[model samples]
Target chain A: MSSTREIDALIDMMAKLPGLGPRSARRAVLHLIRKRALLLTPLADLMQTVAVTARECLNCGNVGTSDICDICTSEKRANGELCVVEDVADLWAMERSGVFKGRYHVLGGTLSALDAIGPQELRIPRLIDRVSTENITEVILALNATIDGQTTAHYIADQLDGQVTLTSLAQGVPIGGELDYLDDGTITAAMRARKSL
Target chain B: MSSTREIDALIDMMAKLPGLGPRSARRAVLHLIRKRALLLTPLADLMQTVAVTARECLNCGNVGTSDICDICTSEKRANGELCVVEDVADLWAMERSGVFKGRYHVLGGTLSALDAIGPQELRIPRLIDRVSTENITEVILALNATIDGQTTAHYIADQLDGQVTLTSLAQGVPIGGELDYLDDGTITAAMRARKSL
Candidate 1:
């Protein structure tokens, strides 16, 4: 709706965000303009700063301001148990829960045969290198339950077999998940993985 | 999940946007960082430019990069008709349809007795000034179909009664709107304002 090119460009770029569309982008831009000093300027400055400093960690593939992410650099995070995730968002999810104490390795993507993606394309070689060099005692595959995720996990498990303790996240019902709403595969997985009381 | 304060602050600010939550903000920031050269830099630059240039038009409430918006300044648009809207967003919506060739006067908000919003609080005084001074022959009250919107329309109509041709948007079923899904008020309005075949 904006006649100005700069405003239109801003809206276009905002529409490219993961959740926002063109309508929402227009609303967001107008809101930012109304609160320019409070929101627009600060957001622009922050984006500029992030653009200048943000980089992928060479060791762990996690994103941070430095070359090596804090998780890879921190001594306390090296708890001998490494968690391998398919994406940076998944790594962030794991961190938000405060469940994992070990370092993380972000694969960036899964091993997809259809897409011609191999282990080398998704930081699997780096994961193997970390396992051997970082004194990691165990490796947890925290990949999603999708077909590609499971395939990548299996490949990683096979590659690191007998080298370290290899494990995959237990498949089961999600928190607050209803059996009536769950798919057959999830129900079956939850049944097979039933633990002893 | 970012260890650096800069990235975390960026995520926080992004979360403050209208449609984004913390998770979405993190995802958007990550996406921006991943596509820094293509999207992030341009968005930041555009936002900065908009922040410096964008302002409310002095003649109308529409947002533009100049003192007077393009519609308000265009001689072709000054066809003795003024479309009044409750917000700049509504003005932009009307402009997108390309139906109304006349200029707009954004009220910024509607008359709200519950919120103690009076004529002076909104752009009602400015609308009154424009109607008398700008040789406007017809004024369209294109307010929303809400109680406040109708109330504001009545107040403006009362103020400009007998001064010029006053009209409001026709109430009826929207384009491709199904009767089964239509609300009672909408059906009533459509029935009362039915057009003869």
Candidate 2:
């Protein structure tokens, strides 16, 4: 607030971002000012470009620069398997791991009765269409382990019960996770799904 | 990384911001993309404007759009007391509190022996020049409570020993601070400066 209206406005907007608060926004604005040429200008330009170009892929609901995302168009990724995620962020996390070569279907969100979000609200119809039209053999539910996520997964599984091979992400102890730090549910799940090691 | 190059680049830049990490950056970028018209476009435009117009005040070193900041040029703020701070952010912080009515001098940094920074490295010389020129009655040292900050304060105090009335901020337990949670040094300082209420 000590700075000009523009600077104050910038700080206010920056503070609205996911991880930034008032203090951090002030620091970021100061940093951007100090590194104007090296960071601020380029960041502005890129944000403008993204503002104009970024869009959701019509085919899979994933965000991209085109009507259909790169994953949908890439021939290598069309391997008769589809990974269903609740949000684009989850899809990006999967991509970062580079473990899945199959295409993705962003559900947008889970079915929530409290919010009145049903299967029709998300990309469920599009996913069902893609499964038959795209020759998908396996449908991997990569949704979160939350209650809503589980309910949504169950709904999707029931929809494609006999149509294709359906699976969900294994619920067990995470890699590099300590047993003592895990919650009771996670410990019980890990114990129930014990490996032959 | 599943997003376009432009999107990826934006996430990377956003991650470098003070409070945001990779996950939060991705979420911010996604949010920006979704609210392009309402938030992203305007934020980008404002950033560009700030990048072009923002500058440090010639006299007080506060960041503003003019040679001298609004605080420095305001006729109402010509109160003879000058507050000295380690950075522009500190000046902003003071302004946000709306407590001080006088002007400010940003030191840019503290005098550090390890960093080879001295009085000349900061705006100490300029501050000394401004004291007589501006007819300053009092100089308040509003630096941090770090070792380097105290060292810098002592250095400044010695430099302007007899020229003007010099004072530093009082050290004590903060308002609503829990005694049990407070460190020994703070408790001791609070005891020494105990007020009769």
lDDT of 2 by residue, B44-98 (tens): 9999999999998889788999998888888888899999999998998898889
For candidate 1 chain B, the 10 contiguous residues with the lowest summed lDDT are B1-10
Model 1 lDDT tens row, A1-197: 55787888888889999999998898899899999999999999999998999999999888888998888888998889999999998998899899889999899999888999988788988888888898999999999999999988899999999999988888989999999999999999999999999
Model 2 Cα lDDT, one tens digit per residue, A1-197: 66789999999998888778889999999999999998899999999999999999999988999998999899999899899999999999999999999999999999999999999999999898989899999999999999999999999999999999999889998899998899999999889988996
lDDT of 1 at B68: 91
lDDT of 1 by residue, B83-142 (tens): 999988798889889999999999999899899999999999999999999999999999
Ignoring the other chain, what TM-score does chain B have in each prediction? 0.97, 0.96
Clash pairs, model 1 backbone:
none
Instruction: Output the TM-score of candidate 1.
Output: 0.97
DockQ of 1: 0.81
lDDT of each: 0.91, 0.92
Query: After aligning candidate 1 to the native by TM-score, how far in Å is the CA of A36 from where it should be?
Result: 0.5
- The iRMS of the candidates, in order, is 1.0, 0.9
Residue A38 lDDT, candidate 1, scale 0-100 = 99
